[model samples]
Target: MPRETPRSSRVGSRIQRVLGQVISADIRDSRLGLSTVTDVEVTKDLSAARVYISALGDREAAGQAVEVLNERAPYLRHRVAQAMSLRHTPSLRFMPDYSQADSDRIRSLLNSGPAGEADNKE
Candidate 1:
């Protein structure tokens, strides 16, 4: 028999999907900008999950959106548990995903050249 996938992984995926839907459709907070569920990490015991989110905005706006999401985590968790029918609802922890920002910064640096060469050319 083949080894089965881990329960935590399955639950994490479900949570990510449900949370994304809920945030986009149900959340009415203005502070919550165009947010995307980047990733979710659930504990082995299925007791907690760290949800990474990215939003289309500046750093301050992203921070505000994350704060709003964290504030609404309990409601989101309940909705997710109901949707998945899980025995134990994992506590949701909202985290801002800065990978996109980092990548953008790296791309800008690469395109700008090592020093002033690109500026001089322009």
Candidate 2:
């Protein structure tokens, strides 16, 4: 049998934890505001990681926030390297988290009622 690869959750979680600290204290990007690290997805070789963020502010600000993160990727990676004892630190890539929006959409759909139920009630 072939050896199974490790799930992203395990590696991603660790990266997220360290990144949260670095962003709050080390990074000096004023454009990023009231954000939470929702999750991270690390590649199998651990060469790169996608950091998912959920911001508690205007939707329009997300673009600028992402730009700031991408620009600071190198600094963030360096910070991670110093903090973590990994053989190789993966490059960081920021991505917006849409899970919250998906949840809201599902809630709205459910509130609309079953497909035929609304018609029957009418």
Candidate 3:
């Protein structure tokens, strides 16, 4: 059976949804590439939120996109506040999500077989 999600996580999910929509529809910065809000983590007291984002490009481009998002976080937060019905809108913090990249690397290694075995055959 699937475990129940925590209250903070539920709130985080809502925040993620609002943030993704706001970023895509409202924010207009060329530096910000095609970004997707991968996840959100909210504090227990709901004081702050850490938003994970992934960009469709190389590492440098993704970093640039994150910088743009961080620079425009206040405006995005305001937009999110307008959309959400929370007692207080959590402070937004943008972060690069590298989980996808890490997973891809692991998958490639697995497909390539064990490094020790390859070295032994040589």
Q: What are the Cα lDDT values of the candidates?
A: 0.86, 0.78, 0.84
lDDT of 3 at 75: 91
Summarize candidate 1's per-residue lDDT along 19-64 as a digit string, tens digits.
9999999999889988899989888878888899888866777788
By TM-score, the best candidate is 1
Per-residue lDDT, model 3, residue 117, is 96
After superposing candidate 3 on the true structure, give the runs of residues whose Cα lies further than 4 Å from its correct spot: 1-5, 113-122
Cα lDDT tens digits for candidate 2, 46-117? 778888887665555566677788898898899889877789888899988767756777888999888998
Clash pairs (backbone) in predicted model 2: none
lDDT of 3 by residue, 1-122 (tens): 12324977898898899888888888888888888999888888778888998887666667888899999988988988888889888898888988777787788889999779978987
Compute the lDDT for candidate 2.
0.78
Model 3 poorest 10 in a row by lDDT: 1-10
Q: Order the candidates by TM-score, highest first — what do you get?
A: 1, 3, 2
Q: In candidate 3, residue 121 scores what lDDT?
A: 88
Model 2 bad stretches (over 4 Å): 1-4, 101-122
True lDDT of residue 68, candidate 2: 82
